[model samples]
Target: MTQFEALPYRHVLTVPTVPTAVRLARETTEDVLTELGVNPRHPTVGPALLILSELVTNAVRHAAAASPQTTVIYAAGEDCLAFGVHDRHPYQPSLYGAATVTEGGAGGLATVMELTLGLGGTAVVRGDADGKGKSIWITLPF
Candidate 1:
């Protein structure tokens, strides 16, 4: 098998469901973005970090009740980067009617949608095809 067959993707990172996982998520994502020559100071970078932060936090908080293990996430693609986080819960998260700057809670999906849209990309979440859990994903053009 060639590299594409052996690896199939570019990067993958996982962290246990803990409070500090948000920081780790941001750091790891920034590292990958930098490795791909994306400037850390770019305006979009901060929102991307926030997207990851909220999504990961939700995974740690609401994804699973019985056994919330480490959150599994990966970033990969050719012309764009896609970030996906899989939590242990299968129930899909509900998005609020609308998002606003004044709102402050239960905005994970809304936040991800806005950030991805701002970056000229898309975000989506669905139940895992394997019927195990759910994976929330965001894709942005480089």
Candidate 2:
């Protein structure tokens, strides 16, 4: 089997549900991509970082009430890089319309979906079977 078809490289990190988690996630993502032979400056890397930031920030803002810990999973394969943020909030993310000027910025999930689609990737939301948490994942083709 080709290397690409073999098992993917995976890393998981548990972080406090705080704003600073976004920065930590981004830095860890860069390190993982580099270790996997994916260039840190690759086109997909920027969007991946942004997606990580948005998802982690959303978890901190929306789910910290349920639990103060969030888990980030990163997986890298020959053709794709995937990241998932698992949070204690049971509610799935709501994708609203484009952010208005008064909203102060683009909606997090909306931006994530847009970036993933633009990169010919996929975005998914999965809720835990126990209904205690949810995970948001984005997979981008490299």
Model 2, span 11-129: residue lDDT tens:
99999998888889889988888889987778998888898898898898899989699999887777888878999888886543322223566677778777877888877777999
Which candidate wins on TM-score?
2
Tens digits of per-residue lDDT, candidate 1, 61-122, equal 87547335645455555556677777767677644332443445536676777777778876
Which ten contiguous residues of candidate 2 have the minimum total lDDT? 94-103
What TM-score does model 1 achieve against the real structure? 0.77
Q: Estimate the overall C-alpha local distance difference test score of candidate 2.
A: 0.81
Compared with the true structure, the alpha-carbon lDDT of candidate 1 equals 0.68
What residue pairs clash in candidate 1, if any at all? none
Report every candidate's CA lDDT: 0.68, 0.81
**Candidate 2: residue 82 Cα off by (Å):** 0.7
| TM-score per candidate, chains pooled | 0.77, 0.87
Report the poorest 10 consecutive residues by lDDT, candidate 1: 1-10
How many collisions per candidate?
Answer: 0, 0
